[model samples]
Target: MTSLKLVIIFATLVAVSLAGVVRRDATDDDDDSGEEKHHGPAFLEGLDAATKDKFKAIFRDHSLKGDAKDAALLKLATSVLTPEKLAEFKTHQVEFKKKREQWKADYDAKYAKLSPNAKKAADEIKGLWEKDGMDRAAKKAKKEEILKSLTEAERKEVQDLFPHRGKKPSRN
Candidate 1:
């Protein structure tokens, strides 16, 4: 009789544990479903025509603003987003931030090894980056001048020395 009672108690405990695991799994599924709903294209389809037009304009030119831009974004969000999709987007944003930080660290480490003259030139470039509200035309001209001064061999050597500096892989 005691053995029978013990068996029954063990069986009950096992069933209860299994039930908790199933509940947790269900909760996880619900969260994933919510995220999927937000990321899915169905929400985008919900925006009004006017909102869609505004969104298109913004995409073509970033300078567009005022109520039109606001309306378009609002429409896009309303049409496209569920709470779940927003959460998923937020997750991606967090990952991007982490990557940006890592890249900055690598850049700083690479910059630390530059020769004194090279460092001075890099500092001048850095100052340009630091200058707030600088005119874009002047900045472009300065950048062009810097590039124009470098001989092909010097550019190639620099690119070789700093693998991250060039857009393309060095042939040599």
Candidate 2:
């Protein structure tokens, strides 16, 4: 075999060996500490343990992130489920997506009505919340500063984007 082919074959063998050695019992709780982790909805309880463990692997796949991960996971999970379970699970997924879309639309409408300064403040807070580097305390302090500067009406409009989740958190 060619030298390059030998290297590729050697690398593949090493990877396969390492994977076998590193593999853990998927039934053992999703975490290293052996605590059961729930990756799917409660309805998933109807699924067999092996199937449920398959879902857990999708959630833990580090290669996917953000919306792409969500979409890919949904597709994979749907493909993996049995016909009987797939129908209900797909329906649930559709309902969830509808709710998320509605929420985003509602928030967008409210944001469009804000004053220029209010828009800027809201955007800044969103940026800080998503971006890395800044400590959470520092980010919150900066956000609270902008939030406090808002007119009461703007505050009401921009307060907790996910208000349905709970009371507006005390910004203090």
Candidate 3:
């Protein structure tokens, strides 16, 4: 009977020790996982208040809620721009405008040197080509809108070029 009591006591002690060890291990694992939950600093450091608000508004519209969204937008804004960056962009735009104007002047001077009949023909061709391009774009947009309103069969009946379904079929 004494031997049996001794065995039972020893088993109990072992089980208790194991349970304590298991609990300690679980606590340690919890701590390690908790470290990953730490949040970092915000990204909107240098922009003006108005711009930051605008950025936030855009972020909200894109369904980017919370600090993470704000941080991402602020980081992008900082990386791509500053007052200096804006100034640089404007300067490049001005330079490009000047270059385009110079090219146009040079082209006009060359056109003036051409024979009158040649210049007239060139102008006529340019006007006709521009008009054709504009007409094509307008027709394309109209066709797309019409197609959106159509059943597939009706769309298929519309000619690809002029999109006039009533026109006489062209001979290839």
Best candidate per lDDT, number? 2
User: By the TM-score metric, which is better: model 1 or model 2?
Assistant: 2
Candidate 3: deviation at residue 126, Å? 2.3
lDDT scores in order: 0.58, 0.74, 0.54
* Model 2 Cα lDDT, one tens digit per residue, 23-78: 64545445675445554675475666787777667667655655776687678666
Q: What TM-score, over all chains together, does every model reach?
A: 0.43, 0.55, 0.30
- Off-target runs (Cα >4 Å) in candidate 2 are 1-42, 47-67, 135-138, 168-172
lDDT of 3 at 61: 59
How many residue pairs collide in each prediction?
Answer: 7, 0, 0
lDDT of 3 by residue, 73-172 (tens): 5465556667675555346446656865676676666566655444544454345434534565675565466556655544443322122335866536
Which residue segments of model 1 deviate by more than 4 Å? 1-81, 148-172
User: Candidate 1: minimum summed lDDT over ten consecutive residues — where?
Assistant: 34-43
Cα-based lDDT at residue 160, candidate 3: 28
True-vs-predicted CA distance for residue 63, candidate 2, Å = 10
Alpha-carbon error at 110 in model 1, in Å?
0.8
Best-fitting candidate, scored by TM-score: 2
Model with the higher lDDT, candidate 1 or 2: 2
Q: Model 3 compared with the native: what TM-score?
A: 0.30
- Please give me the total number of clashing residue pairs in predicted model 1: 7
